[model samples]
Target: MFEEWSDRRTLRVFDPPRPVWVDMAATGMAGGFTPANTVPLRVRTSGARLEQRMQGWQHAWLQVSDGRWVAVVSVRLSSANEQSHASIPLTVAAGAIRPAESVTKDEP
Candidate 1:
């Protein structure tokens, strides 16, 4: 569901279901080129902006806003509106949920 790469796009960092090795350097490192490399790479866990998109021999990488590179599969491109909505907590009165009986199979 990722759109084309663009600067100033707010992105959220998330840990994948499985471990994904990420590169710490933005350039001159071939560690991200191969997932089976003996070199020990770090996992992604920081939220940052989209700096650049890099194509690796085996995978695609995204240069984070902080100059660190991470697997594209590890982060999700977030829109400014989504970021703003995420900050506002949902109150119980917001109707995020309802009584179990209120949700019927036919209605849903």
Candidate 2:
């Protein structure tokens, strides 16, 4: 949960109905990047891969994709039983995370 990259898995953001703040560079900042400086991104209910985890000095962060970091309290991983299906690569840009490939291949 802290100080490691969780296995590549799916997760959904439930709280903060709006898109969550991201530390584009994975920097452990106090308030994260401001809206004016960067576009906030939302995780789809369908979910996306869990990338990396960071135990910051004051906050916990999860990298949902390359260069996309969200606070731990904002999102929840798809339950182990519910995430039996595969998660394709995500296309992140301008506050959205879309599946890059149509096919969903199980992780090896």
Please give, for residues 1-104, the per-residue lDDT of candidate 2 as tens digits: 33254553433333322333333234322233335335323323243434343111112334565656644422233423354344122223333221223322
Lowest-sum lDDT 10-residue window in model 2:
51-60
Query: TM-scores for all candidates?
Result: 0.19, 0.17
List the pairs of residues colliding in candidate 2.
none
lDDT of each residue in 13-32, candidate 1, tens digit only: 33222222223134222223
Q: Whole-model lDDT, candidate 2?
A: 0.32
Per-candidate Cα lDDT values, in order, are 0.28, 0.32
Report RMSD (Å) for each prediction in the order shown.
19.5, 16.7
